[model samples]
Target: MRVLHIDTGLEWRGGQRQALTLHKGLLSHNIESLFLGNQAGELHQLCKNNHEEKYAGFAFNGELSLTTHHEIQNIVKEFKPTIIHCHDSHSAKLGSRFHKSCTIFHTRRVSYPIKFLSRYFKYKNIDAHVCVSEDIRNYMKQHFSNTFTIHSCVDIKRFDRVVNKTIFDKNGDINIVYVGAFSNQKGVDVLIKAFSNLAKKYNNIVLHLIGNGELLQPMKTLAKALEIDHNIVFYGARKDVEDFYLNSDYVVCPSVSGEGSSGVIKEGMAAGKIVITSDLTANKELIDDGINGVMFKTGDSNALTMSLTKVINKEIVIDHQKIKEKVSLFDCSNTIEQYITLYKKISNK
Candidate 1:
């Protein structure tokens, strides 16, 4: 069966990583797979670097772009793919426009609710709804059927590299790395407050903030205001997150909202580092209370501070073996197989 993957993103994030992984996996399985995405995106660059005509990258800004729509139409006409896999909301909307020609599968990465009319208009033509987390799947099932849970997986092989500690090297006696966009949804402010409180008790510990967003400056300002800027190192954005993950003692996914199967938790678990995340409904699927991961109240800085304190004091021990075993079940290999099975199941019909 032929598959056309649509992921028009401007950055290299978990969704783009998953799209690239699936595209490569499909090719490895001898499936005729093609990709279309933003011309400037890392995902498109990766595809282009392969020097394959099966991939197409455009200057896609949004679903309203006429050029992007025409390019997708031309690709559809030429590729004649049996399955059209949309990797984000914009791509889903654009892909849905061609529902009559091919089956549309949209993957939702967040668990945020879509209103009834908006949801229907968005998903009415979608043949399948692929959720990156079980929480997202359950939520989508309330609005539509044919929903599936496929965890946002990490390639364990990617973390198998030798960490040189050259970029984003570890700092302080205890290093806790936070890798994600700096935003209110990611709870960067709460993380800063919690880290400041944690700092009051420990001087040798450090909080490494990675990734950049509009809230980055604000978070930095907040850290300085809290008199903890010296302890908190803002690395902005780095491609060598795996090395940071490897060299750190813990990975913190301090998300207060908008999480569907955290990539930080998965990558951290794969690297054998202890993951401390907020106790969101989806995060609970990846973390258990005082088990594989440490969790705190969703938005409570005090709860997060206490959780980190417990982790620091060895009050809650993370079993490396247990984490490895649990995370292996959601490896990229399994994720690709699940998608292939779903594609075959729907394509055959």
Candidate 2:
């Protein structure tokens, strides 16, 4: 099947990663795929190696721009894809124009903000909605009455265990890793405070934060105020995430809002590293509390601290194989096939 994936986001966040994975999956399956987005962004660069044609980045706001309709129409006429699987709301609305001739599947990557009548008007043409988790699926169903739940697939082998674990390497100090943006929704401040508490209990503890955001300096300031500045290391938005996961002993996520089955959680699990995430629906789907990983109350520094202490003290017995097995269900190949199934189903209608 031929598919054209469209997204306007420029940041190299989870959404972009998922999109790239989908593109690659389609290619690996011998299905034609193309990506449309801001031409100058990372998505364009990432698509450089793929043997696929990328259309020019159009000047259109994701939420409100229909000005690029003529250009999109031209591209669709030229490519003639069987399905226009829009990866974001902007692409979905744009794809709505060609819905009569081709299947248009709107992949809802996040929980879109809806304010009364505005939402009522925003979803008039989307044929089907795809959500990453049950929580998000249920949420959309409650609001729109039409949505499908599919777990975000991951590469299981990419992060599987490479070597057997030795003794708790307590001599080099416990390494804590945070792999998300430095944003308010990430609850970075809560992590800083929790790290401070854990540091007081154990002198040889350090936190390595990966990724950057608007609140990077503010979170750094919070660490200093809590007197844990010396124990923190900011790697600032990295592409070599697997290397960091391999080196770290534990991974922590402190997001307080806007999460749907985080890719980071799956990555940490696939890499066989223990995880401590917030008590949110997205996180709960991955962590089985004292089994695969642990959970802490969202935005609660004390709970984060205690969870960290348990991980550091070897209180959580993380089964390496079991954690790795969970990632199998999310194989990108299966995810693409599911999309293909949906595409065929929708197109025939």
Candidate 3:
């Protein structure tokens, strides 16, 4: 089967990563697939020779230009895809205009602004909507009324377990790491505050932040004001995050806003590193609460601090490999096969 995947993005993140992984998996399954996205996008360069691109903007603003729609139709005609999978609402709307021959599926990867009109409009275009987590699915169903939940996945092999069981040497400091963009939604400030408290107790604890964002300077200032600046290491925009996961004792994700499914937590689990995340729907989906990983109340620095302390004191027995294994059920191979099944069913209609 021939498939066309569309992403309305520029900067690479979890959603884009999933799309790329799915593309690669489809290729392995002997399915011909084509990827379309911004020409300058990170995923654009990863596409095969059959892939096409439409660089709408650096950011998707929900606007659909006629020229863009015309280009999509041209690509659709040339590729003759059996199915068109739109990765976001922006691309879904554009694909809706030419939705005749191909079966189209839209993947709702986040709990967003939740605009009433747009939700209704989104319900109108795509044949089926796939959400990355049950929490995201529940949110969409409440607002939009129809959506399917397909848990987000990771490349298990890429996040292979670290062989060296040697204790991570942070010079007697316990290393706490956070991997993601420096955004307010990620609650970097909350993490810094909580870590500051942990620092007051365990002077040998360090916080390592990987990735860059708009909130970097403010978070750094917050760390400085909290007097834990010396205890924190900000490795901005790291490409090699696996090494960070391997060398760290634990990972923290204190998100205050929308999170479909944290790829960071999965990667950490895959790397056999303990994780402490917020009690958000997305995070809860993966953590079995004191089983695989620990979850603290979202936005509660005290709760986050307590959870971190528990993890450090050996009160929590986190089976990082077991936690990692749960995500395999949502692996790219299985997810793509689900899409193929859906496409066949829809096309038969």
What are the Cα lDDT values of the candidates? Answer: 0.87, 0.77, 0.78
After TM-score superposition, the amount by which residue 9's alpha carbon in candidate 2 deviates from its true location, in angstroms, is: 0.4
Expressed as tens digits, the lDDT of each residue in 1-349 for candidate 3 is 7878888776778889898777777777778888777666765654534353322222333456666676777888888887788887777887666567777788888877667777667547577778888888887777655477777787767766554444333433688889999987899988998988999899678888888989999998999898888888888876677778877889898899888888887887877777889998778888888888889999999999999988888887777567767767766667778876766776677
Q: How would you order the candidates by TM-score, starting with the best?
A: 1, 2, 3
Model 2 agreement with the true structure over 197-294: per-residue lDDT tens digits? 88888867878888899999988888888888888888788877776777788888888998887888888887778888999887888788887788
Per-residue accuracy of model 1 over 125-213 as CA lDDT, tens digit each:
99999999889988888888788888888899889987867554446888888999987899989889999998889868889988999
Using lDDT as the yardstick, the better of models 1 and 3 is 1
lDDT score, candidate 2, position 230? 80
Q: After superposition, how far is residue 110 of candidate 1 from its true place, in Å?
A: 0.7
Q: Which candidate is the best by lDDT?
A: 1
lDDT of residue 222 for candidate 1: 95
| Per-model RMSD to reference | 1.7, 3.2, 3.4
Which consecutive 10 residues in model 2 have the weakest lDDT in total?
163-172
Superposed model 1: Cα runs more than 4 Å off: 40-42, 49-53, 166-170
TM-score of 3: 0.90
- Worst 10-residue lDDT window for candidate 3 reads 52-61
